[model samples]
Target: MKQVVENIESKPSTPILGHVSPSDVECMEEIAGENWNEDCAVYAFHSESLFIIPKQRNIKLSLATLKSEIYTISPIRVFDQNIRFAPLGLLRWSSRSRGLHHGTHRMHNKNQRKRLWPIWVLLEH
Candidate 1:
């Protein structure tokens, strides 16, 4: 966790251009392709792939392919649970996979229960 924080702090922060509302599923589709879902958006944010343009107020996201380039419609890469930080399969488990409310799972005391909040990411349509 310290390494992750160090890595993030080392890079210059990118200015946010605009917001993506929950209603804008279309924009999410463009980035994640067909069959896009909440997991896709979550993955993008977790992987730090979304960025803003120099002169544009709109935000854009890019998915990496096997060649380590921005992905396009026709050429899908190995984007699955196998990738680090990718949402794990519903039934499968692995060292890199984190379950829903991962932090809460370790809390055995009832008083430690905390309300889980939803994550909201705004995407342009």
Candidate 2:
């Protein structure tokens, strides 16, 4: 007896609903740049940080104070200034621990692991 093997092709999955358009993205960028009201300016310590909120919430809250109060919202953008790399501190959580690469151990390579030393820099606004 002989067995036959067949190859099958798969179709693309359905597109996500409410796809964002260029215009929508532009509008959101414009809205995000807004300073809001005087009250908000006082509370907004980080001007560079962008707070993302839904259209409905933005429309409902006329005052920036109220909008600022609503902590729950979509993910906000992390400004470059807000990000830092400290070699000796908790800030280096994103970086790998200082030592040989895990693969190097298996390979028995004694050469340097091309260690990265990230210096911490503080800039004044």
Candidate 3:
């Protein structure tokens, strides 16, 4: 993981154009000659082989989340304009375990249960 981060940081930063479009994804699928799958496409995008512009806002949030180690990728919403290109994920167990304070003991207790929130990665359609 450290090596991966170092590699990314060492590379010259390129301005990410924008989120992948549906047509672009279709083109990639066509170019892949029928071997394409959602998993492979996703990996390609993350690996930078697919070349969609990174959403700058999401990038910042993603970096912060990575450093905090508090979230996990959930899913990509294909057609939703509000959340198309986003790092959709769930909060980590440890993060969720941090309970709210300044309330009753039962409410503030670390042992108090919490549910994982669904994170949406908004992208352009």
Separate clash counts for every candidate: 4, 0, 10
Deviation in angstroms for 37 in model 1? 3.6
The regions of model 1 sitting more than 4 angstroms off are 1-20, 40-78, 84-125
lDDT tens digits, residues 4-101, model 1?
43444544445434443333444643544444333432222243343322211333543333222221111111234342122212222221223222
Model 3's number of clashes is 10
* TM-score between candidate 1 and the true structure: 0.18
lDDT of 3: 0.30
Which stretch of 10 consecutive residues in model 3 shows the poorest summed lDDT? 98-107
- lDDT, candidate 2, 28-98, per-residue tens: 45443433221110012122222223343332222332232222122222235453211111234422233
The TM-score values for the models, in the order shown, are 0.18, 0.17, 0.18
After superposition, the stretches of candidate 3 with alpha carbons farther than 4 Å from their true spots are 1-75, 80-87, 93-116, 123-125
Candidate 3's TM-score reads 0.18
User: For residue 10, what is the lDDT in candidate 2?
Assistant: 62
- In candidate 2, stretches whose alpha carbon ends up further than 4 angstroms from where it belongs are 1-5, 18-51, 55-125
Instruction: Give the per-residue Cα lDDT of candidate 2 at 81.
Output: 46
